[model samples]
Target: MRHTKLGRTDIDVSQICLGTMTWGSQNTQDEAFAQMDYALDHGVNFFDTAELYPTTPLSAETYTLTESIIGNWIATGGKRDKIVLATKIAGSGRPYIREGQPITAKAVHQAVDASLARLKTDYIDLFQIHWPNRGHYHFRQAWNYDPTKQDRSTAVSDMAEKLEALGECVKAGKIRAIGLSNETTWGTQKFLSLAEERGLPRVATVQNEYNLLYRTHDLDMAELSYHEDVGLLAYSPLAGGILSGKYLDGRKPAGSRGTINGDIGGRLAPQQQAPTQAYVDLAHAHGIDPSALAIAFCLTRPFMAAAIIGATTMEQLKVNIGAADIVLSDEILKEIARIHRDYPMPI
Candidate 1:
């Protein structure tokens, strides 16, 4: 696996981050262990998880089970020092998490302690806020997104408070770096500017949904990433498995993400299917696995730091990992661009 510097941090992480959202849902503990073992054996040293995970059918009961699985792995003599671990504290949305409260200094401290205890680790390599306290355009909300109602001064103060809390975590040796997820360009810039001004923790990375089907980051966010050194930890690079072409022929394979979550979190709308099919066809025409092609595309982007990949089975894990080695030619890229132009923002 290829490694890159995580922002300006001394630590280097694998270009392909092992995503663990499926651990306690679609997969058992043994399956999760096997996937981690295989990934580590294949040189994947970066793992991403969240406080609210195992999210195939997100519920309060299964919350944090994914982290517990990783904690078990760590307990079983897993080499924690060899990997750069990244996890998130969920934002104010889920009722189970702090009564859906916005992230505050107390919330940050509590979240760090909880995540540390669950992960069986003293310090997290990278700790992130799952989303902005206000709201985000992710999860297929871009179409109706409106930033006109935001209160800039209040938002900046909230960011400052969060950074101060992160600063405390840094001094306590509980977290090495801080990151953001489901954030906008303005939000990222504000956080970075605040950190620089107040001498607090700098935002290191931005995790967002970037895939063949979602290219919103290609415009402003890409520029921010390139210039500010806040690399993108791209999640859903396969558009929630739509780019794999498994759901194209109107066949929902048993136990697939779609099978569990019918709408694929609003990603499999009717408009998106045609473009997804085209990309799948392009991969087949080029003699490459569609999943591998989709992942390889994320790696080739100049602003991408790592592509977060999740799989329910070892077979899927193996196929996804091989994407790190699949080098797409100019011909393949041109074909991809053509498809993107023909159908932009299908979902």
Candidate 2:
């Protein structure tokens, strides 16, 4: 696996981050452990998860269960020092967690301590906010998202308070770095500005949806990544396994994300068929695995820090990780661009 600096931090993480959202839900603990073992053996050192993980179904019962699985593995295998772990604290949305309250200093402290205990670790390598309290255009919500209703002063104040809380975490040695998820270009800029002005924690990375079908980040967010030095941790690079071509013609194989979740997190929409087939066909025409081709496309961008890959089965894990080694040729890349124009904004 290739390595890169995590923003300006001294830590070096693998270009392919092992995502654990499927763990303890779509996958069993043993399956998750097998995937992690294989990934680590292959030099994949970065693992990303969130407090609201296993969202194939997130519930009060399964809260922090994914972290517990990882913690169990680290405790049993003694691999804590070998991995660079990253996890998120869910923002206000679900009532079970903190009564669905907005992110505040007390909430941050409560979350960090609970996560530390469940993770069986004293310090978390990277801690992140799962989403903005003010909300942004992600998770297929961009089509009808309205930002005009938000209060400007309130948004800045909320961010400032969150930054102060994160700063306290850093000072207490609870977390090494801080990051954002499901955020907008403007929101990221505000965080960057506040961090610089207040001398708080600087944003290290942005975890958002970035796949062939979802290219919203390609326009403005890419500029922020290049100039501000905050790289993207691209999630759903395979579009929830839609790009594998197995779900084509409405075929939902047993246990597939589509068969289980019904929507594949809004990625397996009927409108996305043509776009997905174009890339899958392109991959086969070039004698590459369709899944690898899809993932490889996400890594091609210069601003990509790491592409997070999740799999329910070990075979899928190997195929996704293999993309890190495959570099698309100019001819293939040009063909991909041509396909993109035919089906832009597929979601």
Candidate 3:
């Protein structure tokens, strides 16, 4: 697997990050352990998880269970030193976690300690804020997202406090690097500027949804990533498996994400159908697995640090990790671009 320096940090991570959001929910502990073992053995060293995981059907009962599973795996296999582990603390919106409170200095310290205990690790390679408290256009919120209602001064103040807290975590050896997820260009710029001015923890990466169907990151965020040296940890490179054509013609395979979660995060809308079919057809025409083609397309981007791939089955995991090695030829790339022009933002 190809590797890259995480943002401007000296830490190196695999270009393909193993995503573990289904553990302990859709998958059993043994299944998660086997997936982790196979991923690490196959050259995938980076793994991404969140405190609010097993999100296929998120619930209070399954809260933090995924982390516990990973902790168990690390403790049993003793492979903690061999992996670059990354996880996130959820922001406001979930009542079960911290009573739906916004991220704060005290919350940062508390979360770091709690995650450390649950992960059974001394330090997190990359600890990220799952989303902004002020909220941004992610997870199908772009259509009606209105930023004018936000209080800028308050938001900046909150960011300053969070940075100070994260800086303390760095000092305490709880976390090595900090990142952002589901954030906007303006928010990222604010974090970067604050880190420089106050000697706070620098924003090393931005984890956002980036796939052929979702190209919102290709505009201002892409430029920011290039100039600021903040790499993108692209999530949903397969568009919740839409790019795989499994959901075409309204067919839901058994145990698929769509079958479990009815709409797959509002991704089963009518607009995405033609574009999805086009990409899938293009992949087949070139004798490539549609899933691999979608993921490989992500790695080709100039600012992509890693493409986060998740799987419910071992077979799916193998296909996703194998995508790291499938280099798309120029002919295939141009064909992809042509398809993109035909349907830029279907999702």
Q: What residue runs in model 2 are displaced by over 4 Å at the alpha carbon?
A: none
What CA RMSD would candidate 1 show? 0.9
For residues 1-347, what per-residue lDDT tens digits would candidate 3 score against the true structure?
99999988998999999999999889999999999999999999999998989898899999899998999999899999999999998998889999999999888888888888889999999999999999899999999999998997798999999999999999988999999999999999999999999999899999999999999989999999999999999999999988889999999999899988888898889999998998899889998899999999999999999999999999889988999889899999998899899998888
True-vs-predicted CA distance for residue 129, candidate 1, Å? 0.6
Segments in model 3 whose C-alpha atoms lie over 4 Å from true places: none
lDDT of 2 by residue, 1-347 (tens): 78998888987999999999878888899998899899999989999987887777778888788999998998999999999999999999799999999999889988999888888998998899999999888998888899997888799999999899999999999999999999999999999999999999999999999888888889999999999989999999988889899999989998888877888878878899998889989999999999999889888999999999999988899999999999999999999899889888998
TM-score of every candidate: 0.99, 0.98, 0.99
Model 2 poorest 10 in a row by lDDT: 49-58
Question: Cα RMSD to native, each candidate?
Answer: 0.9, 0.9, 0.7
Whole-structure CA lDDT of model 2? 0.91
